[model samples]
Target: MEKTKYSLGYRNSYVLQQYRCLLSIFTGFIILLFISNTAFALATNPGAVCSNGFSQGSLTNADYTNLVSAVNTNNYVNILGNAGGSIPLQVKMTTVESSTNTVKSNFGVITTAGTSAINIQRTFPNISAYTDIIFDFRNALTSQPIYLTNVALSAFDIDYANSNGNTFDDFVEITGVTQAGSTISGTLQPITGSNIVFGQPPQGLQGLFTRTASDPNCTAKNLGTQCQGSVQFSQPVASVKVRYTNTGYLNSATNQEIDLRVDNYCYVPQYIFTGTVFDDNGGITAAQANATNDDITSSGSIYTNKPNYFNGVFNSPQESGISGSTVKLVNCANTATTYATQIVNTGSPIGQYQFSVPIATFNNNTNICLIEEYSGTAYPIRTTSDNKNTGFTTTTYLYSNNDFGRVIAANAALVLKKAQYINNCPNTLNYTDPSLNTANNGDPKTGFSTGSISNMTPGQCIAYRITATNRANIGINNFVMKDILQKQGVNGATVTSVLTNPPLSTTDYTISENPAIGVNGEIKTKSLTLTSRSKRDFYFNTKYGTTVDTQ
Candidate 1:
């Protein structure tokens, strides 16, 4: 009776096999029956898996196949049809200004390698109106730190299938990044399995995802909100302000110079098939050398003499295109075990290239040093100033507090201000400071104050402003004011000096406005008078005019 129930009730097939495995794991067989019932109820009818533009499947492309082939196989694809099928790859360069106001090179590149393949599979079920497609980057080399400088732009052709030809308006145009490479594989892994967390949909995809701006009330106040709406609600003008830690160069040197920027546009997809090999147990089959060899074999021994027999095919123009470029290949093992010089003209016209310090041929060139921004507290992104330190530019970015000298930093500002002062000021009038002090505490007796100056270039203008306090209130009958100018550490006797006259009476200095005076404002010299508390503040101004000769 048990055998009859097992055989008759659940026909032994792939679905049955999975159910039996679930039943075996459960102590109470009743729960297994309930679970199976739920799965069956939730499962869409064979033709109804895709409705209203929703798809559920793995992402990735493990072969070098077009979007059409990938879609028919029921795999995820990023379908991008060429506006015109001339060249599938594109590259562009732009100039961008850095924070220091220096202009540097920015690069952008685009290709229909992986994204189209995934979109094709997603849109295959409806050959009419294409819906939202997912790009699986789980199996991609995303772990590698990529300093992405260029933004990706892409679109699709939905009506291509119905019109029997590609058209501009057939597919919805959406800009995004899939796999950043020349050739894409045909196998894709689900993001859930690959541990990739889904982030907020990009700017352009908000409309497709049915999303509105975060702040409706801020519409009038924010320029970004208005600007974002202008570009199809996708290409926000402030997209440049969007920052992602995951994107851009990782482990970059403190002040490493990235002279060449490469722009990238890519499409990747995954496909499913049924045969002797189970889907879970299958692995990627490499593309053969020729089209004739594009067939499955029991022994898997089909071989074509093409250069890309086992390796992925590079469909780029310009033979041996990237002759001088190089790429580092790594595996999940996290080892720098392999490196390959890029093959030129095999995939893209301007292939990948590596940069290094230009070789020096002249003698005494050892003194010529190159400055690199270093990681440190003073100049967090300041130049490292390299001569022959680390040989490799591939090191990670590191910084410390000691990277910048506080003394140098503090002194730099002073020097700059002094230079500005000298350039803007002229020495034509007289000035005074006394107390026989080179430090310029000021000639209190003479009412002149002068500050010590260093690194003063010849012909540089110097000036001084002096202020006097309590001159009339002081009981001391005699007071002297003097100014001294001399080279630091020089003989004081030889230094030039100036002096002001002594007070003849109690009202030696006059004030237009005094705040220290009391309401009983008699001439109270014996007691605390306004003149006793009176203070003076002076400022110096030396505008360039005719020069004066000091004899």
Candidate 2:
């Protein structure tokens, strides 16, 4: 019996251990699954993945063959249809070394002869849309060559209409290069004393280039040596030029030429929208005041309290930008379909905001709108500019100065008055005293008189009237008014009932007891639109007490 019990106990313990192990494994798997899903969600988000819209050149074997044929026939060919075919690659072999330079089909590679200087030009259909150009190059020749000298890359924009007026003065140079997971660093120096122009007549600007022999990738003369680098332009350029002034062999007797192969060309396209949110505190003009009638008081007097409020104009120098405001880019037709959103910058150049969208996100002529949300704490009593909600069609690559303005609204005018009934209350029966009028002298049974009353007995009843008025031209919304009853004498005064003169509409206003202050306080709230420049009166009656009360 003891041996059987021990065996059963051991089996139960083993089962429990297995169950715990399975639970731990299942829990780990669930955690991993959640982590992977979160990462995928972030990666697929448009705002996270499409900032610059970098795309590589994807060319097929047929495309490469066509590129080679076009280069041989016309010395130029437009490859790769990327960015909705807006940016096409046009490669031209301007000065080719006939003896050794060969444009091959493999990866559409260009192998150049090192005997004489070579010039290659790459043009784009829309240069302005591209921000950076990247490509890979290598020296495939086995024999070492005298370091490539005066190796320059230039970028410039050309005007086809004016044959003699091309702009080549803009600086375009190789910014950085990467080789074997390392950076080849060098400083860009001006290519002076060289009369070499990139394209045809009318060169717009001179190009800049850099050279460094200390980098192994550039100095290596081994076969299959490679280096990846990028070219950046100070301004948009129509074409880029790669020139190798001297490619002489290291051993003059060998007659072995340096084979330079260039491939893997890519470009990053950037479409940015920039704007500012500013306070247009230009102030209200005399014409505006006359039209809106906001400068007049209730008593027929000229109201000049706020001279600089709303002027319906933007003053750039005098007025400053409003920071910490949210701005959104949405479809004009359906604003709920938001494309991007940004907050107004709070640092230097305050109130500036920018949004960058992916390539082909919005085609030309697409209706879009930039909406700025108002901040009550930042700009209290202010109204947005007329064009704040305006929409415009997408047309340009760089949209700038699409500003939103805010101006102070008209002055707020409010008035409040309280009055007590002075005359005696009417009584048909249960009269406290005979001095009171039985026919209701000044006070009516339905309403109370707007006069102060004094020297009344403890048992005498009295009524109070409160009036509120909004004199502003603009309507107010959700306006709340609170009245707290005070304790008088020993037993204190108790409010019997409350009433409004015009009868409060359920849609326009609401009346309720203040829960925070108990039943002693009453609150009235008014909605917007129905009561513009309106007045309201509230009446409540209370009986005088004889005993003393603390509160």
Candidate 3:
């Protein structure tokens, strides 16, 4: 008998093992770039702070100095320099030279790539067929330098055509493209393209791209089994518009364009993972975050007062990490926003990330952050028997569920509640009524800040309380609640007694007083069962500053 062995790989987050397979992708502009992408990575910074460009290389002190300067000035520059510059670098060339049978002007084989940096802006088409849409420049490769910025794509035109009825006016967008020698860089986007031909039902050709080798439906067509290939745009795109500028040169003698190619690739769309911010203070709303062209351009920086950190790993079919790796955030339903970063911590979980969100602009001071590790690209739209060039469709989209792999930042989810206390004032001779629950004391909405000054008196009973609420639908097992009272002001209060409004019972839950502290001074945790949507309140008493000195 022969021995057999097998190996497996994971494509989500929160596991120790998967961190070993580090990938590098580098898409020019756009979050969710991956390994292959890093092959042509380039960063460009415009400000004096931070270096203007970077790739698979080291950062100079100048880069750090610039980055630090930008941070200090509240001016967050790209630092990556992958973003666009002063103007849109433009070029005008055709995918192919005009042949005798095909009239150059009428056929619309291609528009002379625009010459001079035309500030002409084009809208991004909404194509939901494929997530990793690659901008394929098939048969358009040349030796001339290719430069692009602010690529604009239109919607698919099924029945529409240019001056000639032969050429369909389908929109194809490949934004933020750059070329260095044989290396190509930019965003691979899925635009409404000329996939559909005339005399064809709109719905008929929509699913044509889905017949790829990766598609289970494509395993067999008619009666035989045939696996085809397809393309996808990497990661969840922040914008379809390209971000950069450059000058393009054409073939000298022919003056024809050079270094032109539209070849890209896409995957089944499982390149991202998620982690929560414990209590994130996100400001963008879901409607606004998810809306098309509805970008929220708020002033202020993203890294101020952000004390939260989250950790997770990413998995891709090939590799991912360079540009376009973004994490989407939602404050439950209150606000949503996206922060794009390069994939760090490829080799270890120790490289956990920190997302600094300013507390001032944070909506819903408390929030749940959604994390997704995105890595993808877009490729040619095709209807072929082999996996090569099988443009994908929505009907055949593959879905994977990774709910358990969610991530949350450290030092998040701090909760505090108030407990009523009957009180009297210090120096009763001239004391006024004990104003409880006042702005000076504690507001019901914002919780307690400063304790009641009038209520401060020796031997007066004060209740320090805590309220726990279970938000999940399912019951929690072995719920542990631990808290250490803070040292208030100069002298502060000291815990004198601990008691439950209703004493704890073993039948349902348990509570311990003065739980033992570990060698590291960490307090022991309390364990109990908490029912779904249930609430519990605990009360204890404390003595105010006993030693008073002249102020």
Q: Write the per-residue lDDT of candidate 3 for residues 146-204, one digit (tens) a residue.
A: 23222222211111212322212222223333342232222222322112211212323
Per-residue alpha-carbon lDDT of candidate 1 for residues 478-549, written as tens digits (9 for 90 to 100): 333222333322463322222111211234323222112111111111122222213332223322222232
Off by over 4 Å in 1: 1-32, 35-464, 467-483, 486-551
Candidate 2 RMSD to the real structure: 24.8
How would you order the candidates by lDDT, starting with the best?
2, 3, 1
lDDT of each: 0.23, 0.40, 0.26
lDDT of 3: 0.26
Work out the TM-score per prediction: 0.17, 0.34, 0.25
Judge candidate 1 against the unseen true structure and give its global Cα lDDT, from 0 to 1. Answer: 0.23
Ranking by TM-score: 2, 3, 1
* Cα displacement (Å) at residue 41, model 1: 10
